[model samples]
Target: MSLHGIGLVFLAVLTGTASVLLAVALLRWWDRGPGRRGARLPQGLDGSLKPMVLLFRGQRLVDATPPARALLDRISAPESEWTRLLQWIGPRFPDAIDGLSRIGRAGRFECLGQSGTGSATLRLLVEQIDSDLLRITITDPQAEYAGIVVDSMSQQAMEEELDLLRRSLDQTPMLVWRQDAEERVTWANAAYLRKAEAQADEPIGWPLPRLLDSPRPVPGAGTRTRRASLTQNGAVFWYDCHSHPTGDQTMMFALPADAAVRAERSLREFVQTLTKTFADLPIGLAIFDRQRHLQLFNPALIDLTSLPTGFLTARPTLFDLLDKLRELRMVPEPKDFRSWRQQMSDLESAAATGHHVEEWSLPGGQTYRVTGRPHPDGAVAFLFEDITSEMSLTRRFRAEMTLGHSILDGLGDAVAVFGQDGQVIMSNRPYRELWPGAESLAEALACWQAGAEAGSGVAALGARLTQAETGLRDTGLMAGPQGQLLGWAVTKLGAGRQMVRFRLPDPAAAALADDKAMLASAG
Candidate 1:
């Protein structure tokens, strides 16, 4: 190499390096133009900045900043433009820019300018470096940042909701599975895997058919099957599986088909068991709500209430049973069903109270005793027992008992009142009518009256009279003896407390006939 040639080479290299450095400096200086020149926010700043495509070139403005979501919402014009047709009618943009007529000079924004109806405020900030490649930040009046606070709260709430859903479904002893839009498994709770014998380590990314039995997949098409489930081994199970597009793919889930079948079987068994049990029960049972609405009733209830055919008592809504209650339910003497409105009010006021048993005498001469208990949710269970036979017997006994009092007033015959024992108590009206009133019956029977209240005398008379009047005792009838019309006068008032009245001739014979009539009335 000669010295002269080396010097020339060095000189050319130096010139090229200088040119490159100068170009780099110019570019850096251009980028700083906006910042160095104290580019300040415009007065009364209201964000209305929008990027516009220059009409001179076939180009588009693109933004992929401030999170992908916000950027997309900004650039993609809605199908129906935000601008009105009337605004574009009388000259647009450039004509409306205040200072620059025929040329829009409103900083860096696309806007309706003045003559536009419902004119709004707008501001623009141009961000450019070097020649022209630019990004214009558009600030619209309605735009507001949903800052970190909202984002944090939203994320927390979503996490809690998902956690709760997971816990609820987990406790259910059933397998569950979920798939993503790509048909890949996104979630499968523990039960889903445990319930399935052949669950894979992870069910993600497998084709939809791969999770099931061998099946063909047609692009963009879907199909289902009931073959040997991929998740279960040695278990012949059916799954209702389907897919729906989520985002780029579909999400799918598999639920046990047997669960539904089992539920149906159980419901059927329960209904059958209840029908048998209800028919065997002697007491009628009808359940009603606080509103006096009947819910459940046995066959006896139907017989007693004369319920209609094809009545589904199990599902009777409260209002439905009101009609039935109005028919069969009744109240005893002095208290009728019509006055029972207060009972319903009090039952609903307090929770779970044991109320008094109510009785009713039906127009058909039948007696129905009703008792009710409140259920946990304010529903009441009403039990009705037919006691017509019992009540009839009781009333007859009372009538026969007072008959002695009727004769004691004046019978014109020899009469003796015993205190249920053989001890003579009173001579009665016939004696009082013949010998005049003597010691009161209670005083005369002194010793016998001592135990009369509790039937001590009553038991004694049964034994004493049994021996005295064999014929009368056999027929539960007794009249004065020494006369065909009368064997020995005897009467019984009660088992616990006894009163006996004896009469002669007509009174005794009349009493025997009355006794027969009383017993018949009781039945």
Candidate 2:
């Protein structure tokens, strides 16, 4: 009876084992679907690929492969939670999280290893495995395997990077500051503190305008650069400010530019002064720089040169200006066109040393006194003055003198002009014949005195002339050439001058007059 009972228990155990084997075979056949027939699945039954296969349900990590667990441990993540995994690798997989929430539900991302380690990049693929499940597969597309280990020095490296950025901000010459979304300053560099002259009591919460009068608008969501000014220590200062926006904050940098601003202002003032001085000048003035380009010209220069204001404003070169002047016939005419340019070149060379000066007679019957003088800093200046009226007057005076000489020479009487110093200044042809060897009025008088019988010659006449008053006239006889007696008369002229005239004797008339006088006396 005991054996039969044991046989029945063994038979029952054998039937249960056959039913379990048949159920296992059916489940295996169902798991091998047609979609997974050609898909390359990872080999190795020891769960080596398990860490790389993550299963998610309702955005939660329900299960993970062995590779994924190894990766999370290498990244030094806190727990096996989905949030912790995303946080661990979010910096490297920025686009993956966004794509996971979208329809179609397929995304790719790059997974980087920890800092300070040589680790190969992992290509991560996420796709919907079912309606309520997602599968994440990590693979090395380049087939280069590397250990995904987190370096122990990652925290130290991050701290060092932050310290380096802070030192850079402090050493930079530009003033740098950080502001929060509420427009409240949160951080400022050493340069900012120095430029603002901030006291120890001042904190980051201080108003921006109080440190330096900032007039620019607050930066929005982009980058911008602008110029601004402030008054410090009773002096105006300039700066070039730039801004960059972060997620919820903005960074600003202000560089000093006061020197450039002041220099530009001084140049403008100097140009204004020069313009005023040139405005009042009567003579034509033109100035050229070292490059031979015209830099300045006065109004007189435009009028005298007859060049258009637009042409001058275009800043023509010196050669171009002269060429235009020549075309207008405003300058002196040259013998040859080619030679004229060469002459201009020579003039420029000579003017460099301030040794060029000339008179230009234009075709318009105008005369100009042109002078070229060297100016400071390798510059040149040209001056033009109209002298036409003065030259015309001189010509007219010479012509008058010639006509007066011709009238005096045609007279029958001998005439001589004397100055206040008793020097013979002018004489006609007749006077020259009478006193051929006399060099001066004093010499001629000396000859007459030598030829005189007593005091009746030029000596007596000279004495009488000296005693005569202004506007007085006197007549006398003087020994002429060939021992002939000539009637001489003296008349005082204005401006300390005297005129002397000599006349020939009428012998026949005098003798007739004498005979008549004798007959009258006898009767």
Candidate 3:
């Protein structure tokens, strides 16, 4: 009951109260570990309302909320996949576990329910509390961003990164797409939707194979581009697609190849048409390309040149072809061996201007007409035609005409021939002497009046000959100015021709001419 006893008891009560308060503070600090500092779960979520959440230390599932536990029980099948926490989460559980184990500090991924569980996509968020601890919260993906706060700098950086990714995908000239194991379209860039002629909203859940007529490449095959086609805007579009497999999905890149395919088709058809046309050519044809290589030849060429088909098919150069032609005696040989190369060069130059021509008279008495012409694309075409028969006929006709002229010259009578156009085309030597003053038969007839006034009776001969050529014949007598008597005849020669001949008269005609001239003057 003294003062010292009362002070000691008050001190003991104060020490006990201090000790209890310190213990409570220590317990509170222990409960609020690094997990609380880093966790971003919803602040006001009740125990019953919050989505499933689980924490892992290394590979071990150390803690789980009530919803998490319930989900694990519902998904786990004791007979099959109930061995570990990862297996209990069902399909794609290893992906989640790998992320949780290997993430640097924080990460997020999508987890989908397997079979017919009807669970919406879960957005799994994982944060590292310490080097060995990871806190995971799986929530509805739609609400995953609800309780998260980001600093301005970090948010700006993320937005920039997202914008760069979007621009990269949109600006690329190729189509980029991603498909799940079931071959359904999960993501496609703007290029892909445009190529498929589909709206952006239609690609999700679309069957990727339906967009093209090509079959999917087998899995594990090396990455090789395969050609495929699509019908868009009522026209066929072509693509060369390259695929890459990653985990359970495939990524594809497609480049437009429609132009290349169309070009090839056009070239093929053009060649076919050329072949058909050349097949029927009678004249030998040889077409060389821009590089001076023999690109085409007809069957007539093979037969005309007597060259082997294989040699022509090998696409020999123009010089080589010419050399072969010389060796085969198909071309005319040049006289000077030293100038042959220059001659060939000159031939090429002349062919470029499309004026090269040559006649080949071969050892076998055959003649060929060869012509060189310019073709498209800096090419040249050579044509060969056999003209032996035509030349032979022309020579024969000239010889026959010369023989006929010799026979006509032997006749003593003055002879003149008129052609179909009423032109004097021929006169024998005697006829030229008889009509020394006239240049032609028509001129002689015009001057006959002068002869008649000088006492010659040949005035009506020209009119009679003209009538004979039109299906009439006349015979008459006449005298020249030297007081000689003559007999003349106008005869039809068929084919619109007439011949006029004059001969010395008999004795009776000579006497009759002299007496008739004196009697006419007296009358």
Point to the candidate with the largest TM-score: 3
Please give, for residues 252-364, the per-residue lDDT of candidate 2 as tens digits.
Answer: 77888888888999999999998999888878999899998899999999888899999999999989998999999997889998999998998888887875898899999
lDDT of 2 at 295: 90
**What CA root-mean-square deviation does each model show from the true structure?**
20.2, 20.6, 18.9
lDDT of 3 by residue, 1-523 (tens): 9999999999999999999999999877766777565553353353224445677777677888665665566543654222444554435344676665457644444454332222234445677777877776655444434322112212333454577899899889878888877777888887776666553345544564336433355777856578888766578878888878877877778888988899989999999998888888778898888889998899988877898999999999988988888888776667875587788888887887776898888767888888999987899988888888988998899999888777777776878877777677887777777776555556767655454543334645766655544433376667654556667787778887878887844557669998999999999
Task: Summarize candidate 1's per-residue lDDT along 178-228 as a digit string, tens digits.
Answer: 554344555666665555434555553333223543232344576443323
Clash counts for the predictions, in order? 19, 9, 0
Comparison by lDDT, 2 against 3, better one? 2
Residue 135 lDDT (model 3): 77
Clashing pairs in 2: 50-65, 50-66, 50-67, 51-65, 51-66, 51-67, 51-68, 52-67, 52-68
Residue 144 of model 1, lDDT score:
42
Q: lDDT value for candidate 1?
A: 0.50
Off by over 4 Å in 3: 1-204, 213-270, 413-416, 425-444, 447-459, 465-473, 478-488, 491-497, 502-523
